[model samples]
Target: MSHPIYLTKSDLKTARSCTTKLYYKKLGYPTVDRVDGYTRILADGNFIVSKIAHLLYPDGIYISANLKTEESLINAAQETIAYLQQDNVILFEPVLYHNHKLARADILVKQGDRTEIIEIRAKGFDSKAHEDLIRYRKLSYFRNKRTGKVGGEWRYIIEDVAYQVGILQEMLAQHLPDLQIEIAPYLLVPDRAKTTSIDNLASYFQIQRLSTHRNSFSKFNGIAVNFTGDVQEIEKDQFLTKVSIETEVAELIEPTLTSAQKYLDYLIEQSSEIFAPISKGCKSCEYRASDRDDRDGFRQCWGDLADVEPHVLDLYQMGRIGGHETPLVNEMILQGKASMFDVPLEVLDDDTYSYRQLIQIEYTQKNKEWVSEQLPTILKQIEYPIHFIDFETSRMVIPYRAGMQTYEQVAFQWSCHTIAEPEAPAIQTEWLDLENTFPNFQFAESLMEVLGDRGTILTWATHENSVLRDIYYQMQVYGYHNPQLQTWLANTAKLGTKGKSNLVDMNALTLKHYFHPLMKGRTSLKCVLPAIWKTNPYLHEIPDFQQYYREVDGEILSPYDVLPQLQIGDRIQVVNEGAGAMLAYQDLMFGENRNLGIDNQAMRSQWEELLYQYCRLDTMAMVIIWKHWQKLCAEVL
Candidate 1:
């Protein structure tokens, strides 16, 4: 059967972002926005919140539909219509359709002449913190208060509900023609400004998967919530709050619905693709070239300009250097320039442009590596017992413990590679907690013990400083009386404060001094490591690093790409990134599989081991980079 073209609520959202993306989405063109580790955890969290939303109305009837299929949409719409016939009824996921556009509201309530639509989102909002951003009654956070423009970060969520309201209004107008119903729109989301009275509220709910795949956290269709507490207690605590966005919906519904209708018409009648104007935003488009066996939509849009080597987009700080109202690349595109060589050297002389950008352009054009003369002096100043550390934390929507607000950061794991002296072997020490308990204080205490008061503490970016500063505040709020920990925090994590900071940012050093054509104007550890590893063949010959040196299809892979994978039933899961670690933590703590009649201890051990190896590799990556830099400095001296 041929697939039907229905402009779904999700489609409306895509069209609003970029109409071209909607075209790519409908045609099943390969895109890079496929479900990944971070998104999977978010999906799992949203699924749990959805089930909790249903607990408030025990009498509500749930209308299930395979939202992917057109036949199911029709069947579900018919079912919802049957439910709507009652004078007073509450429905969950009620399907509404009109003019070939469809939407499934999170919660629908009908009471005599009153009707309400509530959309549940896993996204967090702090009412008190964001009060200034919200306009009174008119919108929650859909506009910039000063500019009165649609510029808020969470505008998409509000726009999504607006589209739903518009479609539902049309459906009612066509189906229940004579019914005079007053519709109210609301948003149900986690309010970080409010605290939960109940302890371990999030742990009470477990995510059980119906699918056989072990890493099926993202498969929301197969999830069943296993709650172990009274539903009434959750209602009393008001774990998630309902916020009315009636005015916000009213402000956007008309225009959103009209544009959606136009998009539907274009999809039906247009023979050629509707191309969005080329801009700097296209740099991050997911429809760009990938390794998949499908046509590249970005290539189709840019033609030969997309294939330009050392492309203008690859220039470091391209937009900031020109001091133009628009991005430099955008201005260049308008002037018919595409290659990095097209950018003139005279532009770098501007005061707005940093010397770093000049070095990038110069060395890249010369095809030569550039190391600063200050490298030897910088290397000489280093103290003994150097410490390289990496941390893994999660900012979950639902607080795992009580007395905490939603979306609070919980640092669960840390790994440190310490070198006591020059040429000494790297000693690895790690910590992890998988129990259903608070881990922030313990995480800080254990980390402090391993990193004593006599080494140069190193990290890739400012993330470590930010995380430590947050934990310092958390320690104060929790009334921890450890003077030494506080002193360590003040001395090491004084990132934005007036105090001296012992922490050294290696990434900053790279940005200031290092330049390699292989880096391609990117400084992320993941990007830099592979570039260095590929260029320096002697790294693979080292005994300690031989395990990561694997050739596949005559191509060498990064150490991160070689992390071990674990097999559970028919699924293989790996923990190389922060998102993967977050998922593993959730599974180990609150997943149904952990509590099933199986080898729970064995599963926990396996997850902990994977976490250990991944964290260890993270620190090891820093060690290798430092070693390469030291060798270069020695040769220059």
Candidate 2:
């Protein structure tokens, strides 16, 4: 079906980012251009949370429809009207319209004369954060730091509600002119104070593929039957709360929505004419080149028109300025600057991502790797038998076992590359636990056994250290005492503000000691591995790393491509990374049904092996990066 041209809340929300996307979205991109796996999981999660939140209002009507086809849009609108015709109806997913705009209000509480609009989002919130965002952002919503989209999390949420309120307010004026009008807008979000009574609160509802439809609740379509078991009953008020109107929010909403509509109209008229330059926001763009349509949204904006390659957006943490409020490079791009080369020469001081960004941009323009003067001294300080450790973890909405809470850190896997001496071969060892058991303590214990009272344990980032600390806290809370684990954690791990950390953060090393031209501005393993792998032929010759290299049509690919394809029913599920692995783990543990023919044992075995390789790649990736650093350090010495 041809994609509908009507502007919805999503389009309204997204147009704040890039108006050009609205054009591609309205015109429709090919099915090949879309990858439904990762986002579909998130959509399902949102739906499940919404459903659970709906339990708070027992009398609330769902206004159900397929929502995947044109038929559903018509039906949903009709269903909403039918519900609205009655007095005092609490409706969920009510369809509202304003001119060419459409929105599915999450929940609407209507009295004889007063109506309240509440949007229930699965995204968590802190009240102070929300309040501060609203207070600060309404002032800057149009200023220099504004994310082209209505920026800030709470700002966007409130903007959405404000948008809905604007539409409903306009419609009600005509539809029920005599009713004494009172309109209130709210956002219902997961309470920060609420803790999941069950281990896997997010696991209960399994998500299906997103409906090919654009503005639809396809995730919840007939999903109620698929959910098994029940989460511990959360106190409705405790779990979810109406956003307090402690500040003046109503004024902010109307102005934002007006701007949203103005932009929407302009973009619609401009269509593909909207020249969206390659900006920092492009870093997370999902649009890809397609089969039927070769020039996808990203390529059209970046490749075809921008005439820029390996652009400024590629710079690490290039999105934000010194403060996270304003998007740095995008604002620059909007002002006609397109490349990192366009950034003026400047002093880059300290650890703020902005400083890192400026440093990267300068280096990229110079076309040289920037090695700090402290490299030799830093390298010398490192104790030998350096253990390079990397962890692969999954924290899903559902907890799998007892004593686990929703989205709790479960360290299911770890890989360590040990260099015992200067000339000795790098020995690789790893551990993975998908044994339908809680592996946090076991993971810590295994890591300790391998690490011993180590000489310099290295991790790419603070993530590993944070995971270990969480394990220590869990040990304390679970009342499972292991003095050995606790002592090792105290000695080796950086606990809070104290503890002498034997572990060195390799990411800090990268930030302080190294930069490669190919790294652009990224410090992530995703960018780092490819940058190092493509440049250093030493990796191609190493037996331990040989399996990872496979030249496909003259372009090398990571071993992630070689993992087993999962056949669930008629669909071949791609196990791409951690998100996919988490879904697979949840399916194997909780989604088992003998009649469905998803071989529980086979699937578990497949995921176990895949997780091992992915984790091993992570650790080995650290080793490869270290090797590169070592080479440069040796040369300097």
Candidate 3:
């Protein structure tokens, strides 16, 4: 029952990141949460593919035995030696253990005493993969001597056979010279089509049933399954198709399964480092959940700590938190590098401060609470009833109209909860079910009627004003004449350009004014809503929000044939079916509306009430936050 003494992929990755992290991981440091579903799928897929590669060269020695431990690496190295001794072509997973360290080679191919190590990745060859393979080969070369084996050759194998060939070949040419191996042309293996008949036979065989708990489709009876055929047909159609290439490789080399098991046992004996946190290991380590305590402390002192740091500038790069950027502005204050005035109390207290504090100071101040409080004061100097309005619109890509960007916002449904009198509760009014044809114009007309001539119009985000302004401009381009449109334009233009005016973003507000313990980790409206109101907007039972969006977006039409019973005051207005199709389009452009309740009609009604309550609560949250900002402004300004 002794723990294995081998380095895992994660351990190697951690070693790359920082030796300290690796050291901590080896000492059994607590990590983070379990891998998400997508990552799990990838890990499983890689293991399956690796096994298939092993089947391709059957007589190959398995350097590592414990699929879960690092010692299997030695098994792989020993397998390579056996293959070389027999002058047999070998397919193997090689584990290189040297100086009490371990690493894995995805596939090792030995042809007549010449061996080449292959690293298999499910991803197509990319620059990152190129860099990783080079590093892996170097590690293998250094460790091969410790395991009493020669580092013969190296190759990087990836999934996209056609497209990645040139890329891989080029990288091999560039990096393999130092290792004294002339780079051969890279090989790409396209995904083999699983014939319908083979799939049926495989399913019928239910070979997986033998190891019910193990979902390995590659390994059967301690041998990799590379080829599939009826026992009678095997002699007639030996090479009909290389269905089980891995199994075929296994059969050719014909290493005893018992020997493979011994190598596996050795790997278990040698692998002793508790999954540690090396800098490189963080890139894709699954055992991070075990390092949660260290990560949390790092996150608190730094900003958002990540397991991996990207070498390139991309979305992935942004996930990394390291070096100078680790210590947040507030943390700088705690470290006595900045003064109190340099960081606001609200900034320090905000629940989303972890993320917001990452941005520069000035931009962070323009949030909901700040605008709401400042607006009332700014309007005190003028003589017009202040109007606070909120609007919901949908946009389309691929130009629903000519002369539009590939994606343009076409306002369809608007719910404006207006606050006219300063002391009065906001009155609610909304316009939905607009015909798709000329929705913008109709929306403009309705807007002008409610807005009147002289009031400071307010919205939650500057994007709202921009949406209106853009529609007005589009109307002019289309030669639609309206005097009110002109007025709306002049008024909005005086405020600012679209998305930069007297509008508010509640996201900004919460980041500035509030910091509930419940809101500690998230800033999205969905997260913020429940944190402030103790309820979720999407808690409904009818017309599942996903289906609603799907119907609206034209992914599919509403099932009118399966119409539910309509109760009193329930208005089921099926506007132009095509118009509603815009809903699905909107959903895709934004995101699936998870807030829609379930599919039952009675539950749908209850959900409708819940939606209303949620929306009302949103406005109420605005009000409460506004009051907090007013008090802070009075005290600070």
lDDT of 3 by residue, 458-529 (tens): 545455667777776777766888887776665654334334343445565555544443343346444443
Model 3: residues >4 Å from true position, as ranges? 1-384, 402-405, 493-620, 627-637
Best by TM-score: 1
Of candidates 3 and 2, the better by lDDT: 2
Query: Could you report the Cα RMSD, in angstroms, for every candidate shown?
Result: 2.9, 5.4, 16.9
* lDDT (10s digit) by residue, model 2, range 35-71: 3546645555566667776766778887756555555
In model 3, which range of ten residues has the least summed lDDT?
Answer: 200-209
Clashes (N, CA, C under 3 Å) per candidate: 0, 12, 66
Go through the candidates in order and give each one's C-alpha lDDT.
Answer: 0.79, 0.67, 0.39
Q: Write down the TM-score for model 1.
A: 0.93
What's the best-to-worst order under TM-score? Answer: 1, 2, 3
Cα displacement (Å) at residue 164, model 3: 5.7
Candidate 2 lDDT score at position 70: 54
- Report the CA-based lDDT of candidate 3 relative to the real structure: 0.39
Worst 10 residues of 1 by lDDT: 212-221
Which 10-residue span in candidate 2 carries the lowest summed lDDT? 139-148
